[model samples]
Target: MNVETQKVKIFMQKHDNQKRALISILQDIQAEFNYLPKEALQDVAKTLEIPLIHIIGVATFYRSFSLEPRGKHQATVCTGTACHVRGGPKILDEFERKLGVEAGHTTEDRQFTLETVACLGCCAIGPVVVVDNEYFAHTSIREVGSILKKYRKKEKDNE
Candidate 1:
C-alpha cells in the first residue's frame, strides 16, 4: 500500500473500522494531512464498506473538512454581525491584500489559507482573527501585517 493508504488504514484500525466512527476517522485523516485527500477518502470507503457518496456527503457536510489541500497555517477572520459592525470586512480586506489571496483561498506559497467565519462566538471581542487556532481578539487592520509576520517568522525559524 502507498503511504497515504497505509496511514488511513491505521486511522481506521484505531477506530476498530466501525462504520459509525466515520466522522472520527475522517477527523484523524484530516489531522494527518491537514485535509481529506481523495485517495484517503476512497480508501476509507473501501475499507469501511461504505458507499463513496455517503463518505463524500459526510466529508462535505463539515465545514472543518477540506477536500483541497490547505496551507501550513490557517487564518480565519470572524465576520458575524458584531464583527461586521466592528470593521470585520475591512480587516478581512487587509488580510486579503497582505496575503495577496482572497478569502477561501490559500496563498501561492502555500504558507497560509485565508478564511472567514460567520462568528467566533465572542461578541465582546468583535473582529477576531484566529491563526492556527490562536485567537487574536479585537483585531484591527493595522494588526494584519504583524499577524502574518509572526506566522511567517515561525516558518523561517523552523527551517
Candidate 2:
C-alpha cells in the first residue's frame, strides 16, 4: 500500500476498525495530513465497509474537517456579535491584507490558512485571534502583523 493508505490503515487499526470509531479515525487522518485526503477516505470506506457518501457526509458535517489541504498553521478570527462590534471585521481585513488571502483560503506559500469563527465564547475578550490553538485575546488590527510574523518565524526556524 502507499504511504497515505498505510497511515489510514494504522489509524483504523488503532481504533480496532470498528465503525463506531469512524470519527476518531478520520480525526487521526486529518491530524496527520492536515485534511482528509480522497485516497485516505476511500481506503477508510473500503476497509470499514461503509459507503463513501456516508463517509463524506460525516467529514463535511464537521467544520473542523477539511477536504482540501490546509496550511501548516491555522489562523482563526472571531466574528461573532461581540467581536464584530469590537473591530473584529477590521482585524479580519487586516489579516487578509497581510496574508494576501481571503478568510476561507490558505496562503499561496501554504504557510497559513485564514478562517473566522462565529464566536470564540470569550466575549469579554472580544476580537480574538487563534493561531495553531494559541489564543490571542483582545486582538487588534495592529497586532495582526506580529501574529503572522510569529508563525512565519517558527516555520523558518523549523526549516
Candidate 3:
C-alpha cells in the first residue's frame, strides 16, 4: 500500500467507529497529514458512510481545517489591534523577508506556511507568533531567526 493509504488506515483506527467524531477525528487526521488530501477525505466519507459534501462542509466550516497543501511548519502572526500597534507589520515584514514568502503562502521548500491571524487573545503578548500551534509571545525582530531554526530541515545543498 502507498503512504497515503497507510495514513488513512492509521487514522481510521483512531476514530470511534466513524460516527460522531467526524469533526475532531478529521481535525486530528488533518493535523497528521498537513492538509486533507481529496482521496483521504473521500476515504473518510466512504468508510464513515458520510457524504463527501458533508465532509467538505465540516472541513470548510472550521478555520483550523486546511483543505490544500500546507507546509511542515505553520506560522501564524497576530494582526489584531494590539499587535498592529506593537510593530506587528514590521514583524510580518521580517518573516516575509527571511522566509521568501508572504502571509498565506508556503516556502518553496515546503518547510513553512506563513499566515496572519486576528486576535489570539494574548494582547499583552503583542506581536505574537504561533508556530505549529505553539505560541511565541512578546516577539521581537531578533527572535524570528531562532524560531525558524527550530523547524527548518537541513538541506543537502547546504550540507
Candidate 4:
C-alpha cells in the first residue's frame, strides 16, 4: 500500500461511497492532497463503482480542482478589465519572473503556484492579488518580491 492508497481509504471512510457524493468525495481528496493524484482517483473509481473517465471529467470540469500537484502557497492575480487597465498584467509578469514559473505552473521547489483570475469583485482595488486565501489589494509589480519573500520565508520556517 502506498501513501495515496492510505489517504484514499481515510477519505472514503468519511463518505458512504455513494455515487451522489462523488463531488464531495473529490473535494475531500483534493483538500487532502492539494490535487487529485492518479492513484487516488483510481481508488475513488473502484470504491464508488464509477468509471474513471467520469471521475476524471468531474475533476477536470471544475477549475477549483487541480489534476496536478500544487504548491503549498497559491497566488492568484486578478486580470479582469479593471485590473488589466491598472497594470495587472505587469504584476502577473513580475510574479512569473520572480517565481521562475508561468502563470499556471508551480515553482520547482513546490513552494508556490502562480495563477491569474478574471475577477475577484474587488474592482475598487483593481490589480488585486490573493495568496493562500488572503487578498492583497492595489497590488503593484514592485510588491511581488516582498509578497513572494514572505511565503518563501514561511516555507523555510515550516521546514
Candidate 5:
C-alpha cells in the first residue's frame, strides 16, 4: 500500500478506529505530517466507515487544521486593536522582510511561517510575538533581526 495508507493504518491502530476519535486521529496525522494528505484523508474515511465529506468538513472547519504544509517554526504576531496601535503592523512587516515571506505564508526553506492573529489576549503587552512556544512582548521593529537570529541559531544548533 501507499505511504499515506500505511500512516493512516498506524494512526487508526493508535485510536482503535473509533469514529468518536476522528479529531484525535486527524490531530495525530497532522502532527506527524505537518498537514493532512489527501490520501490519508481517504484512508481515514474508509477505515472509520465515515463519509468523506464529513471528514473534510471537520478538517476544514477547524482553524488548527491546515490543508497546506507548515514550516518548522511558527511565528505569530498579534494585530489586535491594541497591538495595531502599538506598531504591530510595522513589526509584521519587519518579519516579512527578514524572513522573506509575507504573513500567512511560509519561507521557501520551510524554516519559518509568519502569521497574524487578531489578538493573543495580552493587550497590555501590545505588539506581542509568539515564536514557537516562546513569547516576545512589546516587540519593536529594531528587535526583529535579533529575535529571528535567535531562532535561526537555535535551528542551527539543533541541526
Candidate 6:
C-alpha cells in the first residue's frame, strides 16, 4: 500500500520469475525490509506465479523466517544442553521480562527480537546470550539488563 512496500514487491520480482525460488526471494525481501511484510509475500506470490497459500506455508514452516516484522537487534540465548544446565532458561526468562517479549517473539516496538538457539557451538560459553551476533559468555541475571542496553539504539546512558 505504501511506497516501501511497493518497492519490496518489485525487488522480489527482480530475483527471477520462478515459483520455486520463493524461499530465497522471501529471505532477500526480509533482509531488505527487516522482516517479511505480508504485502511483500503476496507480491512474491503474484510475480513468481506461485500460490499465495504455498508461500505462506513455506514462510510459516521455517523458524529462520519470521512472518512478522523483527526488531533492529536480536537477542538470542543459547539453550543447548550445556547452556540449559548452566541456567540458560533463567537467563532467557530474564530477557523475556526485560524486553517484554517471550522467546520466538519480537518487542512491540520492534527494537529487539528475543530468541533461544539450540546451540551456538560455544560450549565453553555455555550460559551465553548473543545480542546482534556479539557473544556474551557466562551470562547472569545481573548481567543481561546491562548487556541489552548496549545494543539498544536509544541507550545514551549505555554510551
Best by lDDT: 1
TM-score of each: 0.94, 0.94, 0.77, 0.94, 0.91, 0.89
- Residue-level lDDT for 109 in candidate 6: 80
- Report lDDT per candidate: 0.93, 0.92, 0.85, 0.90, 0.91, 0.84
Best by TM-score: 1
- Cα distance off (Å), candidate 4, residue 29: 0.9
How do the residues 55-122 of candidate 5 rate in per-residue lDDT, one tens digit apiece? Answer: 99999998678877889999999999999999999999999999999898889998898999999898
- By summed lDDT, the worst window of 10 consecutive residues in model 3 runs over 150-159
lDDT of 1 by residue, 102-131 (tens): 999999998999999998789898789999
Candidate 6 Cα outliers beyond 4 Å, as residue runs: 153-159
> Per-residue lDDT tens digits of candidate 2, residues 124-154?
9878899999999998788899999998898
* Clashes by residue pair, model 2: none
> lDDT of model 4 at residue 90?
94
Better candidate number, 5 or 6, judged by lDDT: 5
Q: What is candidate 3's lDDT per residue for 49-98, written digit by digit as tens?
A: 88899999989888778887888778998989999999888999999999
**For model 6, where is the 10-residue window of minimal lDDT?**
150-159
User: Distance from true position, residue 21, model 5, in Å?
Assistant: 1.4
The ten-residue window of minimal lDDT in model 1 covers 119-128
Give the total clashing residue pairs for model 5.
0
Cα displacement (angstroms), candidate 1, residue 156, comes to: 1.0
Candidates ranked, most accurate by lDDT first: 1, 2, 5, 4, 3, 6
Q: lDDT for model 3, on a 0 to 1 scale?
A: 0.85
lDDT of 4 by residue, 23-104 (tens): 8888998898899998899988998999999999999999889999999899999999999999999999899999999999
